[model samples]
Target: DIDPELKQTYDVMNRLRETIKNRDWPNYNQAFHPLQGCSEEMLAALQTLAAHHDEIGNTFTHHYTNGPLEGSNNKIKVIKRTGFGYRNFFRFRLRVLFAFRVHTKRALITK
Candidate 1:
């Protein structure tokens, strides 16, 4: 038997999928209409996006979360204190990117 939480998530996913499959256009403030004739193509694209969403969501949940990024920002503050602050935001950004490239690459590989 599926857990209650998983069942709820599946229901929500199905609703969203149906909405995408049926919607005439990406409009706002109206109920989405079923595309009617293009169900196959619509559903195929939607299913592909859903699968990618699940993959990315799983990666975000299991690794490379915002927690570590925030922690590194805190650590950067300490580094700034010692280095008398990085006045060039671009250089600072590159430094951070370079430092984290290995970890990000590993995460992408594992994912």
Candidate 2:
């Protein structure tokens, strides 16, 4: 059997995940309060999450998200890494633009 403390920690984590997934902002505090003395490490993680709770909840409150912006950033990073030999800033900028243009064209054609 697993240790009692470990089981408690897992239970708390599962509840937190459920609360976030459901966007139950009203019961967020109640969901998290039980973690207060579960374990020092768990409590510390909980504290950090609580500190950024608003930013976290913003995902639920706002219909829009920065997912596309983050995907674009990842694509740019890939292009830069794969074409690491390019030394000119202008050339790099053009390459990024070209890559994006190709991507857009493919997306439009597939639609």
Candidate 3:
């Protein structure tokens, strides 16, 4: 289990769904909603967060800030490194395609 403070932080974040519901903020950073991806669910969650902000009177809300894309990019770099000595363009293309397929499929299933 996570620590109480960590859980509290998470709870606070969940509460921010309401905070973002009512405002016309241009950016999620102002409300600290890091998980506000460009998805419908994220937009809805932001709307909820805005509404909650007004209810609770808390000005500063927070969320999961960073994306895993950078990590995935790093992994791709590693894969490229592993294929560094490939002489044929076709082999390189195959390696990259296979890596992308494996990574994206795993990410989708995990999500």
**RMSD to the hidden true structure, all candidates:** 15.0, 5.7, 15.2
Clashing pairs in 2: none
lDDT of 2 at 7: 79
The better-scoring model by lDDT among 2 and 3 is: 2
Estimated TM-score for each candidate: 0.27, 0.70, 0.29
Relative to the unseen true structure, what is the C-alpha lDDT of residue 25 in candidate 2, on a scale of 0 to 100?
79
Arranged by lDDT with the best first, the candidates are 2, 3, 1
Off by over 4 Å in 2: 85-91, 102-111
lDDT of 1 by residue, 1-62 (tens): 34655454454446665654554223211222333333455556555765686554455346
Please report the candidate that would top lDDT against the real structure.
Answer: 2
Scored by TM-score, the top model is: 2
Of candidate 3, the 10-residue stretch with the lowest lDDT total is 56-65
Worst 10 residues of 1 by lDDT: 24-33
Task: Give stretches of model 3 more than 4 Å off.
Answer: 1-66, 102-111
